[model samples]
Target: MTKGSVRSANGRPHSTTGGRPPGRPAHADPSTTGGQMTTGTTATTPTGPAPLRRPQWVRVLLVMLRALLVQSLWFWVWVLVPAAVAIVLLDRFGDLDMSVVQFARYGGIWYPFALSFIGVGIQFTVHVANGLTRRSYIRAVLVTTLLIGLAYAVLMTAAMVVERAVYTANGWAPYTSGHSASLVAGAGSLFAATALAFTAGGVSGLLVGIAFYRGGALRGFLALPLTVSPAVVVMLLTDDVAAGRDWTFPATVSTVPLTAALCLALIAAAATAFHLLARSAPVSKGLATS
Candidate 1:
């Protein structure tokens, strides 16, 4: 045998190349190796975070409607319960001369209470919607709360009309020209109430939605002013009007129109504030994933 070549016992020349063939291992390559190396280097990187999604306007509206529906039903129950109890107590005690129209007007006093509950419900709905969609916070709050408030106003008006008709038919009291004026006043009241309620609710919902996104206790505290400011103003105005105090000459000319305009302006301001606040809030931490 030549010195350069070594022969095995089987007579085959010994190979010069050492180890495995020139190719990737079963689990290794430039692409695969690079990937493994990169993964190992960034092992601390968090996983399982969900990507952010934009909210759909229509879906947000639907969620709001569903929430409002449940709230409205509960409010109706609340009103009915009190009225039933009053009727029973009155019947048991004596044949009270109070007409159905009077009872209906009295029942209308519960509107604010019912509205407050509805506002809370709407806030919750907006929070959920914001969580799911991470939409423009202002838009979500305004659209949802405004629609709910409008619907509530319409329902209350219809109920008032129905109650009035029933009372008139039952010979409780004849519908007078003054009643027509009163109805017009009531309509103005409804418009004002709707605007104020919607504005307050929208602001509340936006704040709550921000809380849901940011994870803080401040939202709860902020919610108070957002909801109560408009309410307080409306109450004071209504009280003044009821007391026959006219601070503004224009307002005195037609109290209803003036009140309605003021209420609408407040609602618009609230909506604008909600939108601005939402836009200013930080993006949700959990929603920052790519």
Candidate 2:
């Protein structure tokens, strides 16, 4: 019956405390909140080393690997859909001469190169926003880039095996020969080149993304030629790849003066530039200074 008192069920007035009760959580535990039942998470986002914590590299690797798998799956589908359409059309009209291995090989180079932005453009922003260091994120991305490149190459080689069998079964021998660096190796050299090309693409993509992150759309556009140069160098390393493909290199690259060493050097240069630019990159709403 008091002004600020509440009546109990038994009809007795109880005085109000005017404060929250004890032994109650103000917010849910982060781990249990979103179904993330992680243990020993002392804080909302775990920072440095903890006795019960997993290694940062391990966590970073997992995030990178998961992203790679997701991207690679969709990428393979994109690669295969066009390939399937082309195969059907070519086989139907007897234009199977347009090699499937060669067609798919281009994807191995281009997808990773273009998708490399996901590393810095998307993942980096999220991770950095979540309190990760740029240095650690870049290192993890490099590792992921290497892995994705290797994965792209390996998948390419496997697809080639299928192409070879199917093409030969269809009485297509000309395209079946595939690319050999020399008389002894057709698949070996192809695999290595595929891996290298894919790797170059991934790193180049990463650098392109870094440029945009640091400088915005205008800078990204300006960096396009420099970013694409590595893939060009890789393509021109030998006559094995892009020899019979519809795509052509820049007219400035008059001759195939590039070598394996030079191609590697270009990839290394792009990767190094990305590292230098990104090592101290700041997360901001406005464009960064490169």
Candidate 3:
């Protein structure tokens, strides 16, 4: 075809320039760094197994389930062995008085510590890439976190029950009436505290992961105070190690119920922050790709 010819000599053009006609508007489809045209529109590609068979929300739920599974595996593989070893060692070798319930009481805080940093950030990137809205991803994460908290609470309560049975059979004392006044009492308190703290930690973790993923080091460090505030609130409510070792408002709200309420409120705030961060979530480069 001639340079200015509208039609080729044989009445057909030979060059295929990505479906674009010659002299097309530059603004219509700008060139990417890789020379690909931007679609500039949404494309719905379902994710998860059997994408054609399941609804999109069900896929979201499946992703949430996977998230829960990963968290549970981390708990059992990474957190459990060390915890059991420490419990046994402390009970036998260390002279300090101890109970398994005390360790179980603090298990909720570790959930966020495990999930909030590197893992969830990568998950956010993947979920977005796989055609999930940031809104949906955050919601799934929150739901999954709640389930993790509830499952751990149930597990801890069952462990307490078994511990009580063994202690009763062996004629040994477990704990003498503090937060855990009796075995049943301990289970109730631990279950409630664990569930609350786990949910709060999950929320805090979402905030931390999103912050670090978006802002790298500077914003992540700046977000520390806000991102960790939910866990701090949980610590304030449940931990009685020292009065002033960490931030606490026990002077104004000393009761467990009040403290729990405060923690939930903080978790809600963290969730809001998470939504804000994830709405504009960006894909990041990683070693795996390089």
lDDT of each: 0.49, 0.70, 0.64
Q: TM-score for every candidate vs. truth?
A: 0.53, 0.68, 0.65
Off by over 4 Å in 3: 1-55, 70-74, 77-96, 104-107, 176-186, 240-254, 285-290
- Pairs that collide, model 1: none
lDDT pick, better of 1 and 2: 2
Q: What's the candidate order when arranged by decreasing TM-score?
A: 2, 3, 1
Clashes of 2: 1
The residue-by-residue lDDT of candidate 1 on 1-290, one tens digit each, is 54555666887666454434235244344586655633323346567887776446566667667766786678667765675566456556865344232333223333433443445334434454356443543455467666655665565556555544654565442233333213434545544454454344444445444444344557645675654455455544554322213322245567656776775666566556545555555554443431
Please state the error at residue 228 of candidate 3 in Å: 0.8
TM-score of 3: 0.65
lDDT of 2 at 232: 68
**Cα lDDT of model 2 by residue, 76-101, tens digit:** 88887787787878788875664555
lDDT of 3 by residue, 115-229 (tens): 7556676677777676667777776767777777788767766666665565456544444333332443345665676677777777787788888888888989998998888
RMSD of 2: 12.2
lDDT for model 3:
0.64
Candidate 2, residue 269: CA error in Å? 1.7
